[model samples]
Target: MQGIELTLQDEAATIELGEDLALALKAGDCLALSGDLGAGKSTLARAFLRAMADDEALEVPSPTFTLVQTYDLRIPVSHFDLYRLADVSELDELGFDEALSDGICLVEWPENALAALPKSRLTATFSHLGDGRTVTIAGEAAALSRIERSLAIRAFLRERGYGHAKRRHLSGDASARAYERILVAGEPVRILMDSARHTPGPILQDGKYYQQLAHLAEDVIPFVAIDSDIRTKGFCAPEIYESDLDAGILLIEDLGSDGILDADGRPIAERYLESVRVLAHLHAQPVTRDISLGTITHHIPDFDRRAMKIETSLLLDWYLPWKRGEKASDTERTGYFAVWDQLIDLMASSEKKLLLRDFHSPNIIWRGERSGFERIGIIDFQDSMIGPTAYDVASITQDARVTIEPDLRDIMLSLYCAERNALGAFDETLFRRDWHLMSAQRNCKLVGIWVRLMQRDGKPFYMKHMPRTFSYLEVALQHEALAPLRDWCIKAGIL
Candidate 1:
């Protein structure tokens, strides 16, 4: 592993460096703090610990007495003193093995356990340098490379006037996107979206990955284009601050954390009604197929039959087989397609409007201080397309991630329909018919998506929502229009 050496002039500089390291540190990482007693090993380690905990006054007492101190910070952390240890073998009794896998570790006098140290660890040796101290960091190649990338991000932030910003991880979502909040000294906190370039999968159809087939966004361009469109429409979408299109990085305004869901994790009817009104207003306007992106033209895609089928097919490919513990046969699969073809065709016949594919509680933020529809801060619409407006309404009212109680859902649907019908040109009858059909189609896709997320992607959290999704699907399946498909599901025992 290569080493990177830097000198910190004072205690503040030392703490700042530690905070920087804290950004890249994850669970299972080790910061072997090594140096003489007065060389500031504990100082650097304590600073790192405090930053991770987000509490400057956090007690980071030396582990000299206890030999190890564990803190339940955002990322659990362990501080160890090996000098007082009788034997390296005693580490097992101390649960060091489990601790390493559980959180970040900072070990002072790590040389005492040098023979037992994990090979994937980072070692920081501090030494006196004039009035300050020199900290040299060395680690496995992969770890060091990650450190370098963190350093690069720091530089990128500095150039954007966030040199002294306090970076906080906002974690990740189901997609490949990563987010961080950068709070500068006086400026409003900004969000840093780290969307890595998507690696295209094997060419299964017409040299495209599943994302391409589904018309899903592959990078940050769609977000930028969509954000501009939403802002131009006088909505509450976050403003883009600075962007690096090639690097897939965007520094944008931070939408406050006040979500529409209440303490019970259910949507507040008032806020959800406001969102429905927002959709009603949007659908009533003239639709724009084109988005102005400087020299680039961003054309919103149509939610075509191929994309619809590709999504619905996930049920056959993942959920059904997983439920039965057996793969679907050609005949069964063909029958599944036959049922979906009718539903897809019905949805295709509906009038086209801008469909924010993921319109739901999770993507909607409640801005109570704002006016009317602007109070609903919409995010995560990069996969939006020109399709049946009913699709978005169904997604919100059915809400795969959060349960929309049937009664509450009825109120929401009624409010949405009332608002939509107020525009004398809209057809309430046709809209109602399309809503049930689209709801069933969307929920059908979510069933397979949740299953695939668990079985193939190793993310089981979404699986918890499958029952709620299926419940919504059942409600829609009961519609007279979906009777054929409902019968098919019953025959397959997937109902």
Candidate 2:
């Protein structure tokens, strides 16, 4: 969602805002705060705690030394201070997980737990602005939706001059009408706007509109949220003016029709290297407590044992039938299932890292310049996860629709590996081994996914990419680590 830039008149306004937030919070919620030492971090915390329960003796001390402190309230509350932490691992001793299970957590100096925190939590950053302060709040789907409701209520209050509206228009009809007029007529409307439109596709699954909207916003809105900063630093995306996460809409600057994939059907050597470099920079940015993997995991359903089994079944139900034009024999099917199981186990054991699950050609828009390398603009990155690094590398090199030149692919991989080495400890040999293994694993799962998209979802456009996807699988199977899968595919006559 787009961040609202506000200028508070005084600490009273800040405390009032915090009290309003406290009244709105529920159990299992998280609010991460970041700002300089005296920017009212503890002041806001005190205000929130006081509002939760009338415990005047509640010693809401600065958690600078303890790292975290918990207070028993009507709803459990945990206050954390990472100002003294040396690294994220230091949080392990504080029983943070237990707190997350049944409390509303308010964290101060959250940067210390950046890597280990959840991806879908709320974040509030406070900064001094002259004699007052500026606070920016952001969160995942549920949290953002909650905040949106609160904002709507606040807007209603302001509209009636702090008096009540005779009848609240909470059905969001006014909002929808406002958006339509602004979008279709280009008439200036007070709400956020965007250029993207809904085209023919699968009716989004039942009970998933908000989830999907959140996903879309996560992917698209952030470009506008940070567009100016990114552009000044030499990156290209869209410029976002406003976003309402609760309404599932965004007002963003449109990057016109010349995407990199639209300009070049196949990735060239220079473009590939440049793309990899951009990814390296993105991953290398100092992990901020403001962003974390914790929130993403918390919002999306986890791949539990049952979900994994169901996903594996797709190979038999969709991919095999699509590829072979007939049902697989029991023996052949059993072997394929075994290979899938083994790959899933390997993936489960690997170390997790940030992965933009859909990194590929079509998502990279080409904003042309003499420097062909840096002209690429990235999109469709909201589904990024704290998964294997190789997942993203493989997503690009062995892309679904376009075939990356072999020489370019190798060069890009080498550049990525070297960059990783420079940043942290990495075993080059082991990294490459895992990279190949994960590549094979990703392609196998994707084969089933694409087949399901075509057969079950009636999206045949995805089927057009099967030949290129198969080529990636073929190369992956050649690696020694994936020999069992290679042999299994061959024996089943599906390689």
Candidate 3:
């Protein structure tokens, strides 16, 4: 009863619904199909399977004869035809439990095995409607909620004339945002940015939520504003073709897949240098903090001491407890903040710029054929802030995700300094010092982030990067201004 009802006006609509479900369903999900023999259940199942395979021509035979058919897929699927099932005990022999444990299950004639189905399984009951079919998908709240969002996105795209475009799921980053590539015949591919407004977490410190204290974007407005502003400045931020700001949906240009990393995932020297040049070009000019969004004005936040200190504290709060199997002591915490306090004070008068908070490989799209600064496509700047120029420089040079060797790191830094020098009075010494300070600060935050992602978010894939992050931190601490921090790290055992 806790679900949504949809009308499939034609076969195409039925297939679309199946595709939508493919996007919403995950491992351990069971989609129980209920309908008369000719009421389109098999049609829906075939569409779901083909979409999951990302191959339109994928063979999807009915499971009625075999009783069950399984396909090894991105998320493996098991199709079950339970009409021949005589009793609940037979479900066990059919590997029902194994199917549910490993991947998604699409069970036809679910009524025959009602007693054996998962209590949380989604049931799509289809019935003939005039010349079409009507389905009411009912399920537990969690699965139904994801389906609702998918339906909402479909409606949004329909309203914007992209209803018929094929949707291919793209891997999302650490945020709750989702992305899909839109494929339409004879049209340039566009990306659908499905970023619902962020839900605030419980207050963590100083009567503010973690997102509030950290200066993270709470909605898509910042992204839209930054995208518009950056394009005006001749940068390669995606062009928004259509947007529903209230719904947090946008149809934007698809910056192609080429990146600064090579096929082997290592950083390419030339591409990395071009990315460094992007930051140089961006930092050399002054830009306004106020961005206009037609009816609204979005002001970029300053990367204040509060935000910076809170970030560095993540190393204490998450990483230390994870590594040492205990919380950091009060003295250890005090000493860590003492070093950061001095570093922040030293950069109080430093020149500020529009820092693309994540100016690294993952966010940079290499536009090999494009001319000028447009050669680099910059995505993921929603968290943009007015911060010290060295922050962005540090983000790319000592990229947390990529291992930049000392020689190449120095070359990239030198290139950035040379570019800035050509533009105006640039003191390499002060910039390099700030770079080291910012690098250490960012790596400290990342070291904690990797652990937090594993422990709090159940994403252990990030933990593998811990060694590289620690190495980057060690490199940054060699700076003389960071001597106090280095000594503290040694005492705390993180160094």
Clashes per prediction? 0, 13, 0
Question: How big is the positional error of residue 483 in model 2, measured in Å on the Cα after superposition?
Answer: 1.5
State which candidate, 1 or 3, has the greater TM-score: 3
lDDT of 1 by residue, 1-495 (tens): 788888878887787777778877878898898888878888878888877877779888888979999999888888998989899997788778888887888888999998888987899899898889998999988787667756667777878877778776776788868778887777787988878668788776888889999999888888888888887887779888888777777888888888878898977889888998998888776777889788887888999888888888888888888899998889888887888788777775687888889999878888898787679888999999988888999988988888888898889889888887787577777788888888887887888988888877778899999889889989988778898889988988897
Among all windows of 10 consecutive residues in model 1, the one with the lowest summed lDDT is 145-154
After best superposition, candidate 3 residue 386: deviation in angstroms? 0.7
lDDT of 1: 0.84
**Tens digits of per-residue lDDT for model 2, 279-375:** 7665554322223222322232223333334444556667888778998788877776677677657666554554556677766766565354356
Give per-residue lDDT, candidate 3, residue 403.
87
At residue 191, candidate 2 shows an lDDT of 27
Q: Give stretches of model 2 more than 4 Å off.
A: 1-239, 262-264, 285-313, 328-337, 347-351, 368-375
| 378 Cα displacement, candidate 3 (Å) | 0.7
Stretches > 4 Å off in candidate 1: 1-13, 35-40, 125-146
Candidate 2: Cα lDDT at 468: 80
